[model samples]
Target: MIIVNGDIVAQGSQFGLKDVEVVTATVDLEEVRSYRAAISRGLQAATSDARYQRIQTPFELAPEDDDADIEKRPTLPMQPRMHPVEEEIALSGGCYLWDYLRRSGTAGYLVPLSGGIDSCATAVIVYSMCRIVMDAVEEENQQVIEDVKRLCQYSQGVLPKTPQELCNQIFTTIYMGMKKQSSRDTRQRAKELAEAIGSHHVNLDIDEVYEAQKKLVVNTLNFEPRFEVEGGSNQENLTLQCLQARIRMVTAYEFGQILPTARGRPGGGSLLVLGSANVGESLRGYLTKYDCSSADINPIGSIDKADLKRFIAWAEKEFDLPCLHEFLTAVPTAELEPITENYVQSDEADMGMTYEELTTFGRLRKLNKLGPFAMFQRLVHDWSIDRKHVEGDTAPHYTPAQVAEKVKRFFHFYAINRHKMTTLTPALHCNDYSPDDNRFDLRPFLYPNFWKSWSFKRIDMELKKIEKKRASKGK
Candidate 1:
């Protein structure tokens, strides 16, 4: 019997025999028999125990039924466990970070809160950890209680009373901004979210730091780079942007190491720097290498953009942090580029693909096992009249050529940025199609931007045929 929310629910030991049979079909009959016998012995021991005998069984055999017949009966079809994916992700990521902190003897987590969906999700996951620990303490989980005590450095018999108190102890958020690069709106958002989560928040401007670094580079090279708006070349623009991003990374680590001491705790303890790059951005290679993406651990790295958005929406209600709703309306930006009077930079615009499309491309490339040409072929049908396009076309249809171009462009960037994955922060494995190089994705890092084989040539020919067919239909 199980009690949930004040209601008593009968719980049963149910097994999916069909799933077991599928597994047994791959192994030897003797091995299957041995496995079954081991399970039987374990069950017998459990049933014979006084504790087990006191518990009521969900199903009971009739008095007239023979024990042999009961044993020979097939196992019942078990009910599949259904839980919200968002809740599961929160629990998994929260537990992972909590365990990492406890095992590594780290003080807590330090996040560079950019007021973006990715960073917001990472912060909430840390907040979730506080909630989980509070629940464990309430339930009197001794191991968790001991771990929390040591992690938080609480006195004997003193436990955290609320999630906010635990959060202030464990999580630190820093919004590193440049006057010209980061928006006031985003900075305010980060500040409000930090307050909502009760984290130790710091708002620091790095304009002088950025200028100093730029001057040093200019002095060394005898030249300086500028943004594209300032008449700089693409290389110059990228170099300048990367400088700001790399500097933020450096600053984040410094704070992560000293935050504990700053809070009046003993020296030598450091917080784990958390990364916020999602799987969709990773798949499209839309992030700067060694930037915030190069942190100690990324809680939401394996999650897709859509899922992260959903999680954000869920968090707003679940955590009672309504400030998360701002991210939904806010445009996603790196804020590395110079802010113009009229021009605004967006993540989708920079990547040449929306987060939604990136999620589709990632799923096709990994989960569906589709390469460039195959993906192009499938997407032509999948993203037909009913689907949205990158160009904001709502004409209820996309030509085959448009779909092919989208596919080609996606693969082109995916290959060029494959090397970035080598240095990608270790991310929590939440999705089936994770592009993390450490474990979930094991493809070659060095790949040609475009396929250079006969099969690829054949796919090109097929695409041309498709183009021709579409032209004829138009006529």
Candidate 2:
């Protein structure tokens, strides 16, 4: 007997097939029997192969153990195991880029490789997508093969042999350097990583473009914006930095739209721009709006700083890209400011909190649902260090007052920059505490930048109580 399966319920409910007349059809019983017999023979041969026997590991009979021996055997409960977060993030981000490219029929990905941990992580994810496509082709995944062929515009039956070759076809890395904005070390690192990952690397200086923009702005405003080092006002300093960042975005899209045609490809398709902003920076509102935050997609948008560093370390070994080792130990910087001899701006310094603290703050704010006052109340103990009386001197690492101030500052910035989240590029939702507005997080964009009236009163009362308790203890 032969059995056939169909969506009978869907046909009856939606198409009124239930009212239609039932028809019977004759089948070729002899052909069906022959097909079954052939399938059985194939299964028998596959199971009987010596290679199958060597590969399979069946349980032994346990040497006919006695009842007492069986009772004495330890019973271990089954434990649930999850894939590593590193693997999950990498695979998800890689597949996201691949699907986006295939679905949109885009040429490839264009990443502004800044040599920072975030951008490096983005580049690695693109490389991972190349590896995934190559693996799929190896496994004879027809859909993947066809998508890749169409994406690269390869003729029929012409398949890529290696991940590197496929990556060269699909990925382009650009390093945009302005005058004195990017360091030699960072540029070298970007070049080395792109080479190691087999991406098409383009190094261009945007000094002229920046100068032209600056001149236009000066001509319009009758003043040239200067950096803080040159004794510019805070507004001027920020304006100058933002100009550089925005200029880079304009330049990136210009290249992304034309790089494929520039490389002599037949069809002119634009590359999808990839953003590299991490969750911690986004939470703290440290990123410039529409700068690096603006892109087609952000692979590491929901990822925290610590996890990104861990991912870089893992990628160094897994992808066999040793150039990622530099970012592992290198201090994270935006490099938007001039590299002066006296003052060098770091990401942490500008954010007023370490990445570790930022990670904690982000988790508390989103995962734990803690407001500013609540967060301050919790972090007082989390950040506090026990002070032992050593030679009659006691010094706490972080006092409650200090913790409260940090919490307040964090929330203030978070509220003010909550508007930026509305424009954030679609990010891979791998994190538990994502602040993505489109899906995971839904919060008001316009915030007062301060606590509500009642919340402020409560926080003030709490702070006063803590101070009183501290004063009594000190006495």
Off by over 4 Å in 2: 1-81, 154-157, 387-396, 438-443
lDDT of 2 by residue, 49-115 (tens): 5544346576643344433464544223233334577877677787777877877888889999987
Winning candidate number (lDDT)? 1
* lDDT of candidates 1 onward, in order: 0.80, 0.79
Pairs with backbone N, CA or C atoms under 3 Å apart (clashes), candidate 2: none
Cand. 2 Cα-lDDT: 0.79
lDDT of 1 by residue, 394-471 (tens): 332566767777787888787888888888898878678886454455777878647664445666788789778767
After TM-score superposition, what is the CA distance of residue 381 in candidate 1 from its true location, in Å?
0.8
Question: Counting only residues 3 or more apart in sequence or on different chains, how many pairs clash (N, Cα, C under 3 Å) in candidate 1?
Answer: 0
RMSD of 2: 14.1
Q: The CA-based lDDT of model 1 is what?
A: 0.80
